[model samples]
Each structure stands twice: as C-alpha cells, then as structure tokens.
Target: MKKVRIFLVLAITSLIAFTSCNQSKPVKTIENLKAGIIGETTASKKYEAFAQKAKEEGHDAIAMLFSAASNAEAVHAANHTKVLESLGEKMDDFTPEFEVKTTAENLQAAIEGESYEVATMYPQFLADAKAEKVQKAEQSFTWALDTEKKHNDFYSNALSALNAESESGLPTGYAVCPVCGNTYDMANVDDKCAFCMTDKSKFINFD
Candidate 1:
C-alpha cells in the first residue's frame, strides 16, 4: 500500500509538471512591447526631422520619402502603444535620443538603424513574443521587422545613388500604407502592400 501511494504521488506530480509546461499563453510581460513602442516613436520623430533637413538641402524626393516613412513609423508606434495598453502596461513619458545630420549623413544613419532592426532587434523581439505566445505582439513585431528590411534597402540604394554622383531622379509619387506604414516609391507602383495587403488607393500620398 505504501509503494502504491508513492507511485500515485509521482504520477500526479508529473502530470502537474506537464500541464504547467503546456500553458496556452506565454507568461505575461510588456517589456518588449514598450521597447518597440519607444523605438517606433523615436524613429517617427527622427525621420520627420530628417525630412525637413532633406527638403532644406533640395532633395525634395528624399524629403518626401522621409516624410512618408515618418508617418509610417508613427502608425507602428501607435499600434505598439495600443498593444501595450491592451496588456495593461503603462509607458512613462520619456524623450528619445537621436541626431539630425545632413541628408546624406542622415540617410546613412537611417540605413544603419533599419539594418539593426532587421538583423538584430526585431528578430529577438519577435522570438520573445513568440515564446510568450503573444500573437498580437508577434504580428506587430513581424510587420515592423519586415518593414525595416525594406527601409534598409531603400536607404542603402539612396546612399549609393548619392555617392555615385548620378542624377537619381525623384519618384513621381510616394505612398505609405496607413495600416502598416509601408512606404513605396510609386515610381513603379505595386498594386498593394506586400506585407499587409492594404489597397494602393487607401495609401497616404506624399507630395
């Protein structure tokens, strides 16, 4: 009878352990969501500053691009904030740190920042969100991650064109998806945002 009781106790303990391991949702935390929100807020403001500088420098096309990108970042920031709020996470007011440089230098900085998001930051955040089983956060992070990759390519190409001293004509139109903040040159437009399927007609046009 003693041995049987001991065996039953072990079985119950194992069952409890297994059940705990199979939790439907990840452990609740909003650190990553907060960080993402802060990052997006900073990027939005910095890109707007960069847009103004680009316009002052007579890079109208680049200025428009930056402006559109800034709007997109704002959208991402808003999304992150909503998610954080939904999770009952309150973000304290904080100022973001960034430097505004000449258009060329700013482009380089943008490239580096976007590259970091694509290569390091977003990937880790996405993994964490996944591990935590926060599907909304995961989706948001994925959108930002994919969007950052596009921004990196855009900045890199623009920098190369600037360095080449070639006449890189400005696009006829620039559009940003209101839903996802995806920017498009619109020189040769896509029917819709590849990431979010937002209709092209619904995009915010930047002059």
Candidate 2:
C-alpha cells in the first residue's frame, strides 16, 4: 500500500511539469505573452514615427509601408492582449520608446528590429508556449512570428530602393490582416489573409 501511494503521488506531480523525465519544460507562458505585447506596442509606435519621417522625405511608398507595418504591429499587440486577458493575466504599464532619424536610418532600424523578432524573440516565445502546452500563447506567437518575417523583408527591400528613389517596384497601397497582423500589397492581395485566413475585406488599407 505504501509503494502504491508513492507511485500515485509521482503521477500527480508529473501532470504539473514535463511529460518526459529527462526533458526540461518551460514555465513562463504569461511572461512571454506580456513581453510580446510590450515589443509589439513599441514597434507600432516606432513605425508610426518612421512613417511620418518617410513622408517628409517625399518617399510615399516607404511611408505607406511603414504605416501598414505600424497597423500590423498594433494588431499583434491586440492579439497578445486578448490571449493574456483570457488567461486572467494583466499587463504591466509600458511606454514605447523610439528614435526617428533620416529615412535611410529609420529603415535600417526597422529592419534590425523585425529581424530580431523573426529570428529570436518570437521563436523563443513560441518554443516556451509549446513546451508548456499553452495553446493560446502558441497561436499568438505563431501569428506574430509569421508576420514579422514579412515586415523584415519589406523593410529590407525598402532600404535597398531608398538610394535608387524608385517607386516602380513598390506597392501602391498596403493592407494589414486584422488577426495575424500580416501586411500585404493592396494591389495583389487574395480574398483572404495568407497567414490567418482573415477575409481581405476585413483588412485595413492605407494608400
């Protein structure tokens, strides 16, 4: 009877952590979600400022891209906020910090930020959620991760064309996915967002 009781106790403890004995499990689901919110909020604000600077420099296409990316970052923040609330978690107060520079400098900063999120931050958050079996957190991170890749690419291309001052290959308008924060070319988007499958009709467009 003593041995059987000990085994039952072990089984109960197992339910609280890792499924396997040797593999370590993460336990920071809420922390990761909050970090995502803070990061996205800052990105949104920075992009908004960058958009204004681009417009001042007469780069309409770059300005439009920044505006779309700003909207997308807000969507990602909202998604993370929604998931956090559903889990009965409250975010701490946060203020966005950014510096606006010349269009070329601003584009470089945007590219670097997006690359970090796409390559490091979101991937770590998603891994944490997966290890902890947090489905909502996982979904939020996945959406942000996919969208950040697009933002990184867009910023890179914009920086490359900054020197050429060519709008020929640039998008005329920009659209953002409401659910996943994916940005798309307004002239060539499908009926639905490729990331979240949200209807394109629901997308917010900026020309």
User: Against the true structure, whose TM-score is highest?
Assistant: 2
lDDT for 85 in candidate 1 is 81
lDDT of 2 by residue, 67-112 (tens): 9999999999999999888877789997998899999999999999
Give lDDT tens digits, candidate 1, residues 168-204. Answer: 6556457888888888877755798887898799988
lDDT of 2: 0.88
Angstrom error of the Cα, residue 34, model 1: value is 0.9
Each prediction's TM-score versus the true structure: 0.83, 0.86
Q: Which ten residues in a row have the lowest lDDT in candidate 2?
A: 18-27
Top candidate (lDDT): 2
